[model samples]
Target: MSRVAPQGVLKSRRFRDYLFMTVGILITAWGLDAFLIPNKLVAGGVSGLSTVLYYTLQDKGLTVPVGVMMLAMNLVLLVVAVSFKGWRYGAKTIYGMVALSVAVDGLAPFTPHLASHDPLLAVLYGGVVTGIGMGLVFKARGNTGGTDIVAQLLADRSNFGVGQMMLAADASVTLVAALKFGPDLALYGAVAVVIMGRVIDLVQEGLSVEKVAYIISEHSDRIADAILHELGRGATGLSSRGMYSGEAREMIFTVVSRRELDALKALVHAVDPGAFMIISDIHEALGEGFKENGV
Candidate 1:
């Protein structure tokens, strides 16, 4: 059977996407100003390049806003993104990139710099925040232009995907930053990169525990239907064997958010009190109800 969404649901989802991207831009800029910039840590991407150039020019009696540089560079890369990727891809990416550019500069002056002197703290916190912002962008099925666009372009012509391509491009930038800053700072920047990568995965996948429930009972259909209707989640029935009982069984499999676990339990119990039920942790759930497809 096919599930068709109502038009209102589609519109709501679109609005949610825009909100997520908007908040993501704000949070990412906050991270850049509050931690990365103060500590001179570049976590890679176009923003990282802008940070590096911004400081270099500053010492040479030139002052350019990091956000300005980012927008300029992103526009150059945006051309390539539109050329290689479709207009849909380019448009979504443009939203992210343009908003990010505005947010970084607009918020920088108001956002506080580091309060502590520890570079490690800056690296850890800054990376987490930036990663979170990027994760939100990914959740909206969008990408920020610049190296992300470049990565997609290269991935189009190469066997590697975006992650690897991003790493390669970021490495060149990191090396350049190291030359400008020093080996120690460079090492710290590398650590920030690693942390950022992990946090991106964490945010994209979610840090909270999700549950997958397996239920076996004569009333499996009743329980599954209850789950779907009450929870707004889909469930699948799979064939299974009970080796001890020498009987075939139909099992219901469903994934639910942690908050919905209790409701799911109640629904299952009400329908089939004797049902053999098992629930286990799911690290991540990606689909209609959970995470959207990422970049």
Candidate 2:
């Protein structure tokens, strides 16, 4: 009975992951067909390469489907994913790639095209929509096998990092786009890529601005107490040795939202005017007082 319950919960979570991945793929496909494809905004991915190839073939009187090209490209990349990350990661990537490719093509016929055909609007809106979809897929711990595999492989083989490798790949794609589609449209595509990157970060991290403050004060107990009572936040005191002074010290540490920063500072000041404080940004703070676990 106990084993059965755990198995059921595991299955439920897996089902939810698949559901979110599917929906996110569909949304991404819609954004591509409706806005990006129509305007030739190749935002540098396997999808971007597929877009460029789709048009190039069209000009050559070949009516190859963009999704087919993407699927073919992604299938080749899947080998790298499997080899590097193993079957667990490869399985999700395979599913994501196939689903996204099929969705992009399947939805194209019924998907309404952007009537205005404005390049700028297409880039802006398409980037946001596509980014949101990608973010959802990422949140579900899924990814479409594309340049990601290549980037990972390159990072492992070389000293350059994954981010740098990904950037290089995207830049190469953008350069190809410029040569094929003209400088103006390529520039728009590049802008779309940048916008998409920002939107993805926004979706993943959210807008919450949590600040972490470290206070070095002689009156550590008073400052810690003030932080707890006035700020309504927990504070920790760490014992440290001041290397420069060869003296023992207590450092106060606390995390609070941006809104409470001024109040925290005021409290710290009142407790110890001579206190040295270092404030920094926290990308995320998950736990008791902040966001709940698994949220």
lDDT of 1 at 252: 94
* TM-score of each candidate structure, all chains considered together: 0.72, 0.92
Off by over 4 Å in 1: 1-5, 208-281, 285-295
Give residue 197's lDDT in candidate 2 (0 to 100): 89
Local distance difference test, each candidate: 0.85, 0.89
Q: Which pairs of residues clash in candidate 2, taking residues 3 or more apart in a chain or in different chains? A: none
lDDT of 1 by residue, 1-295 (tens): 9765778778888888888888887888899899998788878778888888998999999999998899999988877666766575646777888898999999988988973489899898988898888888788877778777788789889999988998999998889888888877777777888987888778776676789999999988888888888899999999999999989989999999999999998888888789888999887887798887542
lDDT of prediction 1? 0.85
Q: Looking at model 1, report the run of 10 residues with the lowest lDDT sum.
A: 82-91
